[model samples]
Target chain A: MTAAFLRVAILPLVAGFASLALAADIPTAERRSGSEFMGPETRAMQDDDTTNPGMLWVLDGEAAWRRREGAADKSCADCHGYAQTSMNGVAARYPAFDAAKGRPVDLEERINMCRSEQQKATPLPFESQALLALTAYVGRQSRGQAIAVADDARTYPFIAAGREIFERRQGQLDLSCASCHDDNWGKKLAGAPVPQAHPTGYPTYRLEWQTLGSLQRRLRNCMIGMRAEPYAYGTAENVDLELYLMWRARGLAIETPAVRP
Target chain B: MVVLACSAAAAAPGEPALRSFAIVGDAIPDSLTGAPGDAARGRAIVFNRQVGLCLLCHSGPFPDEKFQGNLAPDLSGAGARSSIGQLRLRLVDASRLNPATIMPSYYRTEGLTRVAPAFVGKPILTAAQIEDVVAFLATLQE
Candidate 1:
């Protein structure tokens, strides 16, 4: 073959192989939930609703759903009506596109949006007991359901952005999320097993914190571990990262109100 | 704790100032504290969770320790594998050798992004402490 023919055909093929190597996501069959890494005690806590502390928040959320608040004098029950029916599989498709805001929003933001637009209530502060309760309640509805985040033209760029953040090394340690969750997963980091970081068990109850926390709280904790400045809650970057994690965790069964060490 | 005394000359209020040094090949040939670090004190730093945090991502020759990390290479034969200068360089900043290393630069204070307020302008370990870690790692010949 002529030099031009070799350059045209072989170089592109080589480049394609290189790109594939760089972006090698874990095979679908190999994806494991973070729960699998927990100790038997923690796993048992998650498996049983009676023992799970996260259930307390879920119960509180049930009450909040029915209680009337704000000037509109309407409860979440009035509009959404029976979270068990309306919110089923809802948490599975979060960090979804918002046409009005021209951006992606997570489950927490969606609840706030509904409160302001539908119930005419004040947006709940992030990480507050009330918000955590509501999130856990709604997330519990999607238990055992597979994560199926939106992956269309509108969300493609944001997912890509999240992927960039996941891979980019930051902080004094200069380690990326991929360095631990992707590369060193299933291995022990000082007695604790490093999990594959699927977002399947968010709005989870952590034994260390002794309370329920959102995925944003967990992400911020990880950023701190890397000695990096964590992004504030509800930031575009945070939502984008959630979008990417949920997309990566597609088909994994949701384990909301999960208890973890 | 013994290493803290060595930093008196370089201490700036609450902060420990980074010591200047030259890189020779892939190593820093000089002792960071001018005096050779105490190996005993170095061992204490390595095993001290609040100080070194080494066991967080490394498995060493300490049989007494129940929990050891599996992230980085085993530290059992570290001295047999590297020179004292090399160990010093690795502790100071392993990222200099491999940019993607999860090992924190224990003595570097510049070019870092978004450092927490409590850790601003501070390296993970002081210069004397880095020397102490290097000294201890150099003794792990087995």
Candidate 2:
């Protein structure tokens, strides 16, 4: 081939191959999580229940578990007996698809399902202390378990929508979740390290928030940060995104009540 | 919480509709507001959490701040690569350039929902602040 041919055709081909190699270098689900990017002190905070402020909510959840409410006058403990056994590994698999609801439901939604259906009680408002407490308590049960959201025939559609949201950019800023979590993770922008943003921990303790918050709250924070209008809590878009995140971080160990700075 | 940077009086009686400009290569003068641009004030707006909140997703030369994120590009030498026009276009509205960008439009008011009531019908920054940021960014050469 002529030298001109190489300059025009082969050079662009070489650049394309380099881009593919760079794409391959990004971490896979097995090796990536926000926890790895955090400092030792932050990790320790998530590890030790005593040091973790999120633990306070877990304790409240434990109390709420046994306290009877609603017309039926029953408690979570009444039906399940003990969270450690009955609720174990359950949080790791949510925002699971509910065949009846025809959509995915996160841990909070599922808890409300049990409350409204079984307890004959009113569902708690989103971001309320009682809901955060119960979510923290139930999420704690699945600690150390690997996340297991899936993309089966029944769930593939919502998972697909979630993936679209992850990749599709929006807002006045016109950026997507992938721009950070998928593209720029581990890079330092200001001074903080970006993580793969695995949703392993929900109802996490964010130092920025100065209190315990749900994944929905964090998602809203991100939307605001992006300069996009946030979806109302409990919207299909939000739940679908959560489902996609859970599926994305499928193998990562659950760290419910995680600490984030 | 939205920060009313200058004043409601600074706003023109009839704000012009947000014009979709091409990814910028030319500087836009203080068009919407006639106030003189000030760079020092721009830096304040960028760093303040109640205002620009730029530091949340961006990092710059400032060292006193904590918990600055890495989701977006650092601004240490932004002036070296981008012109004032480019920066202004980005700050005004980036979605038109790349519809999927996560950056907020500092100067857009239309097509947004769930905005704080106080910020309604008002851009996040005035034309003067946009020029001020453009001025400050222009000084950040390597």
Candidate 3:
């Protein structure tokens, strides 16, 4: 081949390599600063520090803890007994496998289970005020306790299922939950920082929603953003996703009904 | 008398109509026009189950749309509050208006995923649709 033609062909090839080198450097350019690793602004909003606005939910939950609600003339107080003593650290080890139900159960599910089995009351709806209050109250008992999701054989399958869902690619974006939350966490998308999808503080009052929602609800929202067909409410998939999130946040303190910006 | 004269001057011919198109930062001047919107069409852009689905973040004037979220601003008087240019900026590229707004730009014709091939170069709403919605908003002025 003529030198001129050879240079012409090689020029485009060199340009292609240059573009590849530029693309490779993009990630380094996007490397997050130290402050970026300290979680997003939403973390501050979810902090259960003494100044949290959602602290009111704890008070409401305490009230509901003592008030009678079921048809059989039973209140949570009748069975669980003074929450401060009986329920301490109970929230830290939940969504565990229940041999009776043959599935994992979170604090909400467990509360409703007790309501139906012992209290004879109708189970409160998910994200309902009553449910929030009760879960907040119960979770508050373990406010300082570190999360301790058991990885026993019985719970392992659900945890695996949850992790699978977290890593599975889905929707129009063809992105997995891990892509943005786990891998790209602390990185800025557009201008807002992405947060690690930890379930340390849940039943959180989100500024985006202007209301309280459970971890399942947040998962569904992420699914919608990914343009994936979200699992229906109360589905095993959602519960499993919640299980995985709780496990990921195993050592983080439980801050239920947390406020988030 | 001064207030009445000022109000009269504000209502003078060409002035009121010009006011309709006026821009004030990012907000509209009037908020009570009474122009009726085609809820059906608006619903397509605002709450279409498979399309615009704006309710995913913003609460709109329509009720009965469950899951009416609140991540973005309320769009009850968006027409009167924003000039066509401002609205165009918001619809074409909201990042230009507010870098942190989670509201997706409906008129962004590129870099969007999961869109049908026919819609690749077209905005979610047509120019006429934007005008119709703006007309409805102009009616909201008091």
* Top candidate, metric lDDT: 1
DockQ, cand. 1 = 0.36
lDDT of 1 by residue, A1-261 (tens): 322223234433532212322225677888999998888988998999999999999999999999898889898899888999999999999989999999999999998998898888999999998888889999999999999987777887787778768877777666678888877888889889999889998899989898899999999999988878999999998998999899889899999988889
Regarding TM-score, does 2 or 3 come out ahead?
2
Q: CAPRI band of model 3?
A: incorrect
Question: Considering only chain A, what is the TM-score of each predicted structure?
Answer: 0.91, 0.89, 0.80
TM-score of each predicted structure versus truth: 0.89, 0.76, 0.56
For candidate 2, write residues A183-229 as lDDT tens digits: 66777655677677788888999988989898888888888766677
Q: What is the fnat of candidate 1?
A: 0.64
What is the two-chain DockQ of model 2? 0.25
- lDDT, residue A241, model 2: 89
The interface root-mean-square deviations, each candidate in sequence, come to 8.0, 8.4, 12.6
Model 2 lDDT per residue over B39-125, tens place: 798888888876777887888888888878766788899889876666777777665565545677787776665554455567777
Supply the TM-score for candidate 1.
Answer: 0.89
* Candidate 3 residue runs with Cα over 4 Å from true position: A1-51, B1-142
lDDT of 3 by residue, B1-142 (tens): 1111101122224422211222245533332132433534644655554565555556667666666655356778776686654554465456445543345555444444443334434555554454444444444332
